[model samples]
Target: MDAPAERLQAADAELQEIDERIAEIGRQNLDAVADAYKEFSAVLDRYEDRATDRDDFQGYIEFREQMAEVLGSIPDDLPHRDAFTEADDELTTGVTSVLKHANFDRARSQLEPAREYAELRSREQDVQGTYRDARSALQKEQSTLETERNELERLKRLGEADLDAPVSLLREPIEAYNDAVAEAFDSFTHAASARAVLDLVAETTAYPLVEYRPPPENLHEYVHESAVGEESLSRLLDLAGYSSSKLDHYVENPQAFRSNVATNQSYLSGLSATPLQVSWPPVASDALGWHMRERIAVVGRFATDEVVALARAVRDLGLRDDYERLRTSATARESLSETDRTRLRAGEIERDLTTHRASLDSVREILATYPPLGRR
Candidate 1:
């Protein structure tokens, strides 16, 4: 055979081997992703079941207590009243004997209250015992649920690792895939990041593009009012170039973030209603902290040069103006005449600093997982 022909045959064989590996990796990745979804679905089902159990138990307790109260309120008939009188006489004889036999002060102290309060509290005690039993059952179920959640979480983490495993087997091909995906998403991610950065800069520069408004006092009413936050989040996501409707499904469902917002609002609402006294330092700090932590998570998952660049850009943006305003308010609070305001601001600063430090730690953790592209 000619030398050129032999060389061509050898190159073709190598290419075939690479193609086979890529195909195998792709199959494995698809399976892993499916498994992850399945595990997540199971975890959600368990959560729903536990939640239902808790709600049902609560309803049962309420119904039982109400029924007991109604029955207890019914006036006793002649026969029942005579039986009660006989039982009271028996109890009084028992207490008299105890008082004679035991230390006088101790017997009087213990028996007097029992005699005085027994009629008033017997039904209540019975109801309380029933409630306690229900609570114990619920607690046991909750423990099981917690165990399942932790196990499922571990399985989900394993699935996440598996989903990314194909990259190791088909590194070159996957790198190609990354390049293609990056090309498709680059403009969108960049624009989104740029817009976010600009917003932060504007707010900090005092040329605020958007105003920060406190959530309504009534959380349930606020949630029911409309889908404003949801719409705003969806608009932001669109602006950032998340074109895939499937990917945007969760974003469109504002109820998902509702729980998060409610929890945060509750924390903030605990401070005094006075705008100046209600320190927003925690919210500003937490928002930045969460944003940075999310970016770090993104980098850890993708571990690409592009993510590193984006993280760097985010760090450079500095704190938002609203954050600075809160900080100033917190500082001025120290000089306030009201001790409560001073204490609240101090608490807010402490919480903000703690969360900010934790966020920084989260970033460090991400860096550890996927060191910047070229670092040793």
Candidate 2:
């Protein structure tokens, strides 16, 4: 090859080498994070499975003690005991630690933009200070004018590099790794287990509906940052659901609590489909206003402007049959009491026929405008 061509080839190879290095770092970090989540999910599944109704009263500790005994010695087929030991430790604290801090992650996302701007601003200030010092030195010696000029240029480049640090080679790889770790934790920390547990509690307690469980602390802060987050599941639960009173109530009602936890286990294990989450049928029309007044209040909590927005979205999507079904069912059953999960109005009521008729019309009109849905 000609000299110039060979030189170009060498430069290309060097650039390729740098690219490969970055790619390798990306792969390594992604794999590390993925493995952490995989292991966490596995450990959680094992604990939940092992802790049966018999051990329900003992809580999660019973499952952990069982794991300790079984994993005490590495099996002959396994590579090493150290892996098992590490996994045991991870099950005990590592997974929980990651989840406990998961909510803070939302808050941290807001802080990131501020953090980057602050760093850039500080770098700008340093550049200005350096330039001033260089100008002062030039006043002290005419011969140093050229030196100061070069120093200012160097400071300019340094400031550029400092402000552009996030895009720098080293910084890029580090940030990629941080993101991989964050996503890793995010995958498992969604409280799939916790959600299931809460559902089970509701089912086992035989309460057709109850307040939802809360997210881990700080996780809920992402809500209210924007209008969308305001309607998020966590925010809704925090706003309208039962408080920390459930924790105390669990002690007073062990059998019921156990049922709740057990039901959660069942729900998590059952299926991937979203189990009828929202309460429906608009509290059976509440013609008397006093009958199922509590149910009416509960429905009011979930049926909000957000629900209206969602109806608009579905209509926009042109899910023609679905939109019709929702509007029609809500219109038809708008004011009927079937507390036994039936359609016919059955319960005793001082039905104000004229007012009840007006109330039914109101339910139909609101549903047509907002759209309503009920699974059953």
Error (Å) of candidate 2 at residue 211 is: 20
Those runs of model 1 whose alpha carbons end farther than 4 Å from true positions after fitting are 1-124, 127-138, 145-167, 170-175, 188-376
lDDT of 1 by residue, 1-376 (tens): 3232233334344444544643754644433333333332233233333322434555334433543343344235311233233322332353222212222223233334223233223333453444344334434444554555554443333222322222222223223433433442343333333233223222332312113243333432333443433333224334234334543464444444344343444333332212111122223444444444444443333245654554444433235444334343433333344653444445643454455455445434433443222341
**How displaced is residue 213 in candidate 1, in Å?**
20
TM-score of 2: 0.14
Q: Please give the lDDT score at residue 306 for candidate 1.
A: 57
Of candidate 2, the 10-residue stretch with the lowest lDDT total is 367-376
**Model 2: residue 126 alpha-carbon error in angstroms:** 99
lDDT of 2 at 372: 15
Instruction: Compose the digit string of candidate 2's lDDT tens values, residues 1-376.
Output: 2232233334344444544643754644433433333443344455554433343546456656665555543243432334445545544553333222232233234334323333433443454444344333333333343354444343333322322122232223323333433333233224333333233333422323333343322222222232323232332333323444653442344344333432333333332212212223222222212322322333223244443333233223223334333333443343323441231132212223333444445434432432211210
